[model samples]
Target chain A: MRRRSFFQVAGATVAASTLVLAGCKDTEVVQPTTTNVLNLGSNDAGVLNYAYLLEQLEAAFYQKVLDTPPADMPKEELALFTELRDHEVIHREYLKELLGANAIPTVEFDFTSLTLTTRAGVLAAARTFEDLGVAAYNGAGKLFTSKAFLVAAGKIASVEARHAAFIHDLAQAPAFTGVVETSGRYTGMATALTPLQVIEAAVKFFPFTVITSGLPTA
Target chain B: MNLFKIIAELEKVDPEVMDRLSHRRSALSALGDFSKKMALAAAPIAVGSAFNKAMGQNTLTDANGILNYALLLERLEYSFYDQALKAATLTGTLTGAARTAIETIRAHELAHVNLLTAALGSNAAPAPANGFDFGSAFATYPGFLTVAQALEDTGVRAYKGQAGNIPRTLNPTVGGAVVNLLTVALQIHSVEARHAAHIRYMRRGATAGAQSTIFPWINNADANGAPAVVYGAGNPVATFPAESNLAQGGISNLATGLGTTYTVEDVSAAFDEGLDNTTVTAIARATATF
Candidate 1:
């Protein structure tokens, strides 16, 4: 009897949201708004739809970086950036397919603020993108419906964090070259962000409509 | 969001559907309970590692093979997090958040273990219990930060390293289901990266480095008065490793219609400090040297 309640509490998935086929047809879905850059349709699918948006932003940003390598870029840095670029591409493509038939349209972007012409500019751009990427995942991980998806989010967000740290270390490495530092105890200022916050930052690069009415906040 | 409220609301919405989900959850949970119990039951009678030896040498075959390898890595991660969270004397809000996140990660790892075990079935050999050699390295508070950096960073690279194992194409050669899980796996890797960055930001010395550095070439930082320069030490960031130089020939190279001069090794080393798994030990030793 005790176990029954435990089972209900632990097993309760969000109403009928998850079991339904990719729920793009939820006409109740709010369109993208000025405030919300990514219009996740609410619930778990909305959250993934949110992720799909960010992946598209990142993939596009890095795509340009590769397309226009700046002058004086080092063989090493450019190569690393390029490798990172490929990853963003893969992420963008992978996410596009993940939504199945119900995926959001691939919104266009303008990362014009990023100066891909110089080494420092490129690294700085890399830093911002990496930071945003990690934060986007951080905010979204809790919203995931499946244990498999949550575990998978852990695997990828850490890579984004690594990218952020590598850039941090490169620009101002801690005593140890690769060692990442902690400013406060938990690092809330860095890692724990909401989708709203992430989208705010993301819009600086990609000015898309933000519509997240249906996404379950919890 | 409060997990309890979420559960309550979910139960209220559809008791019938919730009941089925509960059954599924219990079934999975039972499997988890049984596997753990069996592991414990066998520990006394059988040599712990004898099971792995019987599974034969690590078979790096299809997606199943790749995930098992990842499960092994995640087990190590889950253990490290469990011990670190237990040992840390985190202060105030940071402590609460860290504890929650540590449990979240631990839970996530366990779920991954369960899911992968289901996928592999009898093929899933309980991985040998490998002891992490952190020893007294992460004992001190500052030392904890440093070690956290290394572990999180390594975790990131390791995921990137393992991604190649999952078939990337989905032509019926890979199927949509494998692709879906792989995408989820990638998402999880990103989430862990965020955790690492959070730790790394906190570990930095308060006074060190330029507090305010402008992001040059960003017109808005100057034009709109958005500080081109990011200011001062941030709140705790994740403590944040790598692999071979296999990604030397990336789309970036293809963008220019020429290959990059950088080798895969160099890029791997950039994020993954200890591909050899020696960086942690080396850093520990180097701490005394400098």
Candidate 2:
């Protein structure tokens, strides 16, 4: 009788736990309709989508600048900006293809905060985006489960860093120190921020909420 | 029944049983029930020791080796910049901006060396025995910039190549610390990229012997008179291709995929490549006298 009772209790426990798990999954699917949320998914997909989103924003910013370049922008600076636009576009398109069906939708960015009319203004905004992209890649590197994806991220991370350095130099020549930790255990290292932190900083640029809850923190 | 006898019998049925038991994550999951039962009877300290034993020791050794390799590289870089800065001949020709940039890079290298040393503790490899002799690199300002660019670019690639090798153990204590090394290496990798860009910028602006054609990013395997190996392929060309190679992630035709209007230089500059440890060490040895 004791053995039979034990089996019955075990069956009940399994059924109850299954229901709880299903309820938790349901809550995730039924988010409130008031705000649009961009879920970055999870695991490798999440990391790629997050990168795709940033590349989209960067590509858009450069494209806008190239469309209506600053009157005072030098010929050489304009050429450099054109290269920047092409690089970002390549990155955006490449990442989109990599994500395929898992890719996030095309995002329309809100660039009202940026001043794109003058050379200084444009370069400053580029610095901001480039620095953020570098930090995002650095932070996302350890989260990748696939070695190929990690290598891919590293390839792009350096390019982003190069872009950041050039923009920083052009915007504040002679004394521009690129985005690096000034004082700490990681003094020489570049800035690396979690997805939550990156999204928090980048939220102002996005029209919709970037839900990074599904992204890896470590 | 003896545990060994059972394990031996199980091995006949499944050859990979021992591998599964030794695998960090698998071992931890396998021990869950056993650990819980032990916790009810044994002390918490004993449980912690059991966890350590389950988490293999080889991971810690591998982590230390990577850290020491990085430490050696940083020390070499720091020494290179330190020697150049101390030389009046090179600094004499450098503009104020150029000098300041070198100073900034040197300070960062020093910080990296110190950070790695602290992380490695006793296992830290001693500084290179004879110190580096940069040879003619410091004889001229442009030469110094050339070598600087190569070293910075190499540093970026070396760190990227080792990223996957850094073990991600399951033991919370060791994993937490070792994983930080991966993060730190990545953070430093990008910083080296930034330094490489700035050095390339300086090279472009040189009044004499200027590599004006060279942009901040690598273009079509152009090493800018630094070694060709700096931009060449590693052991397995497929895994580590030349910087000019447009293929990425199995997509052979990036130009066609993106647009034909995107020139080869644009596509190539869009991404950087990593160098394997063997090639990187050979390059380092060539540059440094030690």
Candidate 3:
């Protein structure tokens, strides 16, 4: 959903507070309502922003789910969601600090496609998001010039993969194949998508368009 | 005269020549002597064989060495799955989704082997298909899952360790190739983590009450269900802590208030740590016995 739409649902006061705590004014980070494109810069900055955007989307997603938790959600599952949300927020803020002024403004996400009221729907959507995060980090790591950044991405990618596996099992008990398996492309490795491919899949849940040409291909 | 200056003088006499042919022969002779001195004392003939091996494997200095190490891990992982899939008892032991996951993981591992082998080309390490004794590593499905978790976790750590070996820039062609290989390594690395997580989940499924305590993410080397003993105590102290490490980029998640309400354990569960080459190789060697 658009930022305004999310603010409307979550209450503007809370949104403003969150923005301030995240280290930026809403006006400084959020773009004009008419401008729908978010440009992820080039090189290391672009990749860090790429990661930051994904983490923001994940953190927001988990927060929204927790805020309006389905009544049927089990306690264990609720705890899992809380942990996932916390991890993503940690990752998002870490990238923001690493990127400093170069970081992309907080991009708006649209989870309208998901049916958040049901356990099955939430888990399934989480599986998709988690898997996408893994794939995106996998592909984006090589684009970074700094070994420090590559290793950092590696650290995060593995955790994302774990989350993907857990969520996949939760979505379909005993169906753990999807998270670890990929088609026999790229020499039988798991899915690793270029920025364009990742952004294409991710944009469906984003309210605004993500122009990924600024991101590296290799 | 300095070697380059001599070569430059030689070039004046013969523009097509890059360096002196006699000098190249002497360099090869010196390399042979160095290899002879480094050869296995028990088997003098092994020196010739070692010398015959690709130069890339001998020089573990840069990206080539990283690619070689990656190939070794892939071969190990691929053979593990390949043998497990072929085991006669596996058919009756693991059914349904578990079987499917195993098959899928096998395919990915084999793919990684092929991809890394292709990337390494002549420098590819010897495949240990004949040497890998799956029976010793894991005889039953549950045993298989335990070892699978170990190997996959090791693979993830190994790749992360080697990632720093990739040079940021080189000749465009070589640099591009390194980047492609590094990307491939990253892709396979996360897949390995997924494999570890799923294997942990499957183990939890078999054990009735493990879910509440068991986590998919790596904790202290001894945490969760990680078989630290199988890895042996010979592992360097630095590498052991690395597997279950809770810190990253000098920032401790233990400190509160970045943006989460999770406790210390949850914070630790949120990140996987990287293993250095010595530790990863030791673990791989211990497991490779079977």
Top model number, TM-score: 2
> Model 2 captures what fraction of native contacts?
0.50
Kindly provide the TM-score of model 3 when superposed on the true structure, using C-alpha atoms. 0.73
> Which residue runs of candidate 2 sit more than 4 Å off their true CA positions?
A1-35, A173-178, B1-61, B168-179, B208-210, B259-261
lDDT of 1 at B171: 16
Q: What's model 2's lDDT at B63?
A: 76
Who is ahead in DockQ, 2 or 3?
2
Window of ten residues with lowest summed lDDT in model 2 chain B: B1-10
Model 1 chain A, poorest ten-residue lDDT window? A175-184
Of the candidates shown, which would achieve the greatest lDDT relative to the real structure?
2
- TM-scores, one per candidate: 0.44, 0.79, 0.73
Residue B125 error for model 2, in Å?
Answer: 1.1
How many residue pairs clash in each candidate at the backbone level?
63, 0, 3
Off by over 4 Å in 3: A1-37, A173-185, A209-213, B1-59, B86-92, B134-136, B168-179, B207-212, B220-222, B229-241, B252-254, B257-262
Deviation of model 2 at A194, angstroms: 1.0
* Chain A TM-score, each candidate: 0.75, 0.82, 0.80
Q: lDDT tens string, model 2, A1-218?
A: 46345435654333323322232232122132345777887776788889989999999999999899999999888889889988999998877666655667887899999899998889888988999999999989888766567778889999999999888778765333547877855688889988888889888898888877777766
Overlapping backbone residue pairs in candidate 1 total 63
On TM-score, who's better, 2 or 3?
2
Candidate 1 chain B lDDT trough over 10 residues, lowest sum: B232-241
Candidate 2 residue lDDT tens string, B7-37: 2223332222322232233332323323233
lDDT of 3 by residue, A50-147 (tens): 89899999999999999998888898889878878877877887677555566678767888888999988888788889989998888788787655
Query: Better model by DockQ, 1 or 3?
Result: 3
lDDT of 1 by residue, B116-153 (tens): 55556666768655544446644655555545545554
